[model samples]
Target: MTLKHTISIITFLFALPLIAQEPDPSEAFWNRLQSHCGNAYEGNLALPEEDESFGGKKLVMHIKSCSDSEIKIPFFVGDDKSRTWIFTKNNGILTLKHDHRHEDGSEDNINFYGGTASNTGKANIQFFPADVATQKMIPGAATNVWWVTLDDKTFTYNLRRLGTDRVFKVVMDITKPISTPEDPWGWVD
Candidate 1:
């Protein structure tokens, strides 16, 4: 065989494992998020028409902390840095939780409200229906379904309350990362 043929055969052999690997869209999603660690982005609300607290305030998302299987992102509404988003992966399942704290760094009563993905999404989108804990904590939101989508230039977080007219969405520009904010509430230096 010619040298070119031999080189082609070697390259194909090295790629066999990846070619035979099963698809894991969740992992792809996780990696996409992990790539944004230590960066911050500005966003705007695109639902509910208007809001008292969130309206007219600058919205920001700081993907400040990241690990192999966990990522913590702080969501800031103007000066209120009380909400953080925690994403975790275990046994190939992705989970999302809300970590809320007060200005004094005290945990809120209604915290960690989220759910795990249903493993029925693509690499750029994932849906997480409200889990048992969320239902028990906020009975009125029993039908809430949260989802996230990451594309080349934008990252969006959305919520839909099934059987109701409630919904929320925030679209952040990932293509333009802003300066990282200070540590979020309750987070020690």
Candidate 2:
């Protein structure tokens, strides 16, 4: 074969590895969420009989803060601003926790209960089952499972209580992000 053709083949082979290597699913999921940082979206309860507190109330989710390893999203139910969903990444694994606060900025007794992803989920989805802390904090929640899914048009947060019929889901439209909402309780700026 000609020298030029031989050189081309070698160069192509050298680039093959880089091209074939796919991005880590956790990292890709983080990036997808970070893309919506500083924006807010409105949604409604999408499953199993909404509670009275959340029913008839405006629901909003703000991707308020994002960093390389952590993200804080405040979920607003009407004027109650005491809930924030926190996502953290470490060692190729992702964890999801709920931060609940009082109006005075103090944490609630039943706060920070969540779970870690058991594996590197797909680029658009991750599942978190009840962790030790969650089980201890809320015994009834020991069988809970939560998952988040993101796609080109929508982002959904879901929950299911295994051994029971309880379920909750909220879907946000990524195509149209609204203005940022007021700061969540205990969060300044």
Q: How much is 83 displaced in model 1, in angstroms?
A: 0.1
- Tens digit of per-residue lDDT, candidate 1, span 63-124: 98899888999999999999999999887788899999999999999999999987847889
lDDT of 1 at 27: 81
Query: How well does candidate 2 match the true structure, expressed as C-alpha RMSD?
Result: 3.5
Clashes of 1: 0
Which ranges of candidate 1 are over 4 A from the true structure?
1-18
Instruction: Look at candidate 1 and give me any clashing residue pairs.
Output: none
Clashes of 2: 0
What would the TM-score be for candidate 2 when compared with the true structure?
0.89
On lDDT, the candidate that comes out on top is 2
